[model samples]
Target: MDAKTFKVEDTKNGTDHMLPMSDVLHALFLQRHNDTGEEQYVFRREGKKGHLVDVRDSVKKVRDKSDLSFTVHDLRRSFITCAEGLDISPYTLKKLLNHKATGDVTSGYLVITAERLRAAMQQITDAILQHAEIEKTTLIQRDNL
Candidate 1:
């Protein structure tokens, strides 16, 4: 509806109980389950920054429920698709995805700042949750299928 926005405090956590991205990845890397005896996820503490988590695990649940197949990259692609389905433009998408429009490798190497990326991601997140305001139920929002 309104232009997507987020405040700096949007990501703030409590002083006593806080769960950062690093902590989640750390647990996913070295931690194993006691009952199921399976690792929750595969991650490395020293891996490249912003490298997406192994989404296969989450996608597997979707595949089983839907009786279909898909890949992790498909998830990212679907985000763009959902935005486009709402008539979001390619130029806007380039901004939303924090990608450079210039094709020249040398000249087009303009860096996408983290602030811009976060803002773009917030746009998608806000759009996805917008419909939650429609229904009269306890559900906050639905996940991508």
Candidate 2:
């Protein structure tokens, strides 16, 4: 990667708890390494490791949502499960996602068409959904972090 210009990472949603990519990848890679000894990437928690936050103190709490069931993290799990299908450039994913860092001044310097980026993201989304045995989710609805 060239250089990072963003201030705080993963605060795009104003979300109180944004899980780090490292934790997700570490657990995922561990799942792979358990079978094959070859190492992929080592994952470690990023800044402010486990700063205290409570589930009840969420930005938006879903009462009907299952406690042991689908919390917001499940959406993230679904994302990683999908992104892993191919080596997605994190930069591209970041740009495609309106994750505050969207205006990174690198590739973000260029004004990309929603259609083009949307297509690329859609392809990834389809591949990811397919990999997870999930049918595709439609694009008519606005998508974000």
Cα lDDT listed for each candidate:
0.45, 0.44
Candidate 1 residue lDDT tens string, 60-121: 87899989887856766977876777665565566554355677564355565535554455
TM-score of each: 0.38, 0.37
* Candidate number achieving the greatest lDDT relative to the actual structure: 1
- Show model 2 residue runs off by greater than 4 Å: 1-68, 102-105, 134-145
- Candidate 2 at 145: error in angstroms? 23
Error of 2 at 3 (Å): 34
Worst 10 residues of 2 by lDDT: 1-10
Superposition error at 74 for model 1 (Å) = 3.5
Worst 10 residues of 1 by lDDT: 1-10
Q: What lDDT is obtained when candidate 2 is compared to the true structure?
A: 0.44
lDDT of 2 at 81: 51
Relative to the unseen true structure, what is the C-alpha lDDT of residue 125 in candidate 2, on a scale of 0 to 100? 53
Q: Clashes in each model (backbone N, CA, C under 3 Å)?
A: 0, 1
